[model samples]
Target: MLLEKINGPDDIKKLEISQLQTLADETRSALINKLSKAGGHQGPNLGVVELTVAIHYVFDSPKDKIVFDVSHQCYPHKILTGRKKAYLDEAHFHDVTGFTNPNESEHDMFIVGHTSTTVSLALGLAKGRDLNGRSENVIALIGDGSLSGGEALEALDYAGEYDRNLIIIVNDNDQSIAENHGGLYKTLKKLRETNGNAEDNLFRAMGLDYRYLEAGHDTAKLVELFESVKNIDHPIVLHIHTTKGKGLPYAEKDRERWHAGGPFNIEDGSPLYPYQGEENVIFSCLKELLDTNKNAIVLNAATPMGLGFVQGVREEYVKRGQFIDVGIAEENAVAMTSGIAKNGGTAVFGTFAPFFQRTYDQMSHDVCLNDSPATFLIMSPGVFGSDSNTHLALCDIQMFAHIPNLIYLAPSSNEEFVQMFRYATTQKQHPVAIRVVNTLRTTGVDDNTDYSVLKSKIEQSGSKIALIAVSGLLTMALEVAEKVKEQTGNDITVINPRFVSGVDEELLVSLKKDHRFVITIEDGELMGGYGQNIAAFYGDSDMRVRCYGISKAFHTEFKAEELLDQHGISVEKLTKEIIAALRSE
Candidate 1:
């Protein structure tokens, strides 16, 4: 009842410390209830409930810009800023997003989903405000997990030298999506224990003023801390220690499991949805390889869990000195994998799709150029997967496909992924990239596919139009093909181009004889993607090529299916387009 009456930050500012605690409690209830039904970043948002409330109470939002790192914790901020109905009410829950969105409100400055960008973006905004002679404060709320990232560290270094009104809040819940890894976490632990007296303080070393608070959830103390640095004429770091999954006991015990998920039972916190089933072929293959080959090593950039080697899996390999968590430094991870590979050790680096963007140079020069034979498991690539722009991997094809000596493989099934992983690890010929889909139903451990050949597969044979689908878009393409068949009575050639980096020239040339129109569908960006290459390959030829993929702009806060349909990648859209093209002829 109190929450519904409050509309904005002004309403929060009017509340006393006692009321603020009540507000925090209500916010937590709203968050847990919503996430229990809609499924989202539960722990992160729950942990930051008090902190976000304190922030809105202390600072003037929309004017005093607050940037949330990764923005997963912005759910609380959304609740306080006239968006409570979106989360509290079931019918309106879909109205709000999981991350901060500039389109959603003036309060949200940037569309952030990936980690380690808040500091840099905040600094730029602060600099712009200074240039225009505006006195509004700029605050960047970052997490301890994100601090390990190269970009965040770089921004922290930059903020250190530039003297301006900037407040950086380090939300030290002590866990990333998984347990926080890296040397900086050690420093954070020391700072937490000693109350800011830690030697070799990371923030201080970067030349920014540092202050620590042990109880981050205390509204009065947090308000006082913010008041101390609200109008400070220089950059400062406010290190506040808080408990992740604070209100939930089960979540508190195992922070990683409760990081994000679907609806769960409110009584015992048991997941309402059935377990997604863990058939981790990639990690199993890696484990087998490591068991057989002593010289093989694995590397991850802050997301070891994404690669199938979670905490327990990682420890098994780490004991053998084959697994390394290189923190959020992706560039370093790529280079390190290259080094290990070149030094006669079989090396494989695994990370989330968007995070790999940080290692373009290293992936190209250190790994591909040298032809180190390092294996890269690019997890959750293409548009059908992660809906958030900051986390979307739509540009991976554009980035990796052009690289020479790089062999990129997109597996349609889990069986294929396992085979490719094994082949990539054993082969010493060239650097290999596996564009991993989020969910791939295993077809009962069949190692029939030979990845060494590196060619495309025709899922369905036909005569006229050729439908080339890549990675996760295979199913969509097949559905479109069925619709095409119903409309024209002609079976369209549905080909799954499992490899995107290189063109299957032989297959393309062969199709030109019968297929008049070629439609390339990918769950990545249309610009410089696998589709473009197909278009360019048939530039002089008579084949009419149309590419369907995500657009060139940054797309955020969308359902995967809705986004695909919006991009004209649905079964009906593709079928209709094909019929029209045939009729025009």
Candidate 2:
């Protein structure tokens, strides 16, 4: 096969123009074979196969750097860059991560998982090359979807005046993870319709030289375009239109569903493990709000599906102006939520916890400082969130807990989430953030506690020991209590601290009356986490305090339970430790 003969870009450069199509086809097949079984970025990688082949054929990588935005679309680039065995061989499939890693290959510029960062990263590479008087060309390959992000626009503005060998390729697939949003997409649509001859061009307006190609899948045309921009004196934008899922019929038809997923059937594209169709409590809550309150708005930053608002399910609310997707712009979404709240509208903005890193300034100044009373739901935080270091939000508590006027709530169960979400949306006091777990447990009993009164609920009151469990760790706390009872004939206290940002001072003070040792268990980082607040509260007292949480680091690819156990948070470990501490006393 063509791929078997080729190991790197040098092999591709040796191939004739007529043989390039065969290589591209082989690359696409390899991508399909691995993705169908192992499950990964299907649509994005498939669409970029031809473009990646052409790129390697035209330029000298490692020397001439190419930065892939998000790097989810780098599978084809990986295949052509001496890493094809990771895609072709089943044993080596797990050898490479889904994203670009500098440790794995010199060809990969950065280990990137987030979007809208390629332009800025590539600009830095260009500047460094210029400082050293190197003449190697630098390229930033970004998708049209990522263009709506604030960072991409900022970088593009900078690249406009950069007088060096910088090539910015806008892979216009007319999609982000979902359909593109913001006013910029309108200009992109016009440019695509006119075949890049549109008068009102966003790129050219930014002061960068522009070139357009409609056939992004044509390797011959892509190679010609790359050659034209190679070692150019001034920065330029090459806008090329390409299908998102070019080869697979089902994936091409439903671009969003096929973006990424679990293992799927190769022929029919049916999921190997089909979703059991569990009820989404968060979506139900949003729907109830939208139906009841006319002024209520639900907002997300490019990941509407994360909030249970999939394509068709969200369109109705969108037409009503109650659902808005800011399009990879989390900062804009947070600030907009604040503005909405200040204007007497009920605003709720939510996305995955990792993306909230971009909205720190807006959350602190625009929302919390102003006390807008907006509701922000941080989904899948700590160890329960994305396992990748690039996307892990291990320090979410560190980011949001200390912000003034922001009440960060941690709900332990589905009923608790319902009550807390309802209370947060209805309250007109301070801005509220709820740390939402991926899988929620049910207590069967409806939660009737008024969250307006911030206090921890004592689940099982006992003497000698108190386990103050935060959010998702509440179940483990109960298990520890049960285990201690079975072994030592003692019922240890289990307290569910619903609030993470602020400690329940009254309940904590009361714990000193009967409890000798106070143990705080949280799923986030140990430093500045919920546990530290508890530890600080008992700093001067004789009440011994032990804080349990993830250690501070960029932890990746770990099982949640094993990670907790490693941090001395397991039920058996905690039970034994508690028994020992009691005996010593």
- The most accurate candidate by TM-score is 2
The local distance difference test score of each candidate is 0.87, 0.92
Root-mean-square deviation per candidate: 2.6, 0.9
lDDT by residue (tens digit), candidate 2, 1-585: 889989889999999998999999999999998998899989899999999999999999989999999999999999988889999999999888899999899999999999999999999999999899899989999994899899999999999888888999999998988888989999999999999998999899999999999999999999999998898999999999999988999999999998888889988999999999668889988899999999999999989998999989999999999999989999999999999999999999999999999999999999988999999999999888888888999899999999999999999999999999999999999999999987568899999999999988999989999998988889989998998888888989999988888888988888888888999888989998888988898899998999999998888878898998999989889989999987887
What stretches of model 2 exceed 4 Å from their correct place?
none
Query: How well does candidate 1 match the true structure in TM-score terms?
Result: 0.92
C-alpha lDDT of residue 342 in model 2: 96
The TM-score values for the models, in the order shown, are: 0.92, 0.99
Where does model 1 exceed 4 Å of error? 439-449, 460-462, 476-492, 557-562, 565-585
For residues 1-585, write the lDDT of model 1, one tens digit per residue: 679877899999888877888899999999988988989997888898889988999899988999999898899999999899988889998887788887788899987888789999999999999999999999999984889888899999999898989999999999987788888889999999899998879999989999999989998888889988898899999999988888989888888888888889977889888877786777788788889999999888777777678766678788889888877788989999999989899998988888888899999999999999999998887775677667778899889988999999888888788888888998999999999987565557675778888788898999779999887778778888888788888798999888888888999999988999899988888988999999999999899899988898778767777888898988889989988876776
Question: What TM value does model 2 have?
Answer: 0.99
Error of 1 at 13 (Å): 2.2
Clashing pairs in 1: 383-523
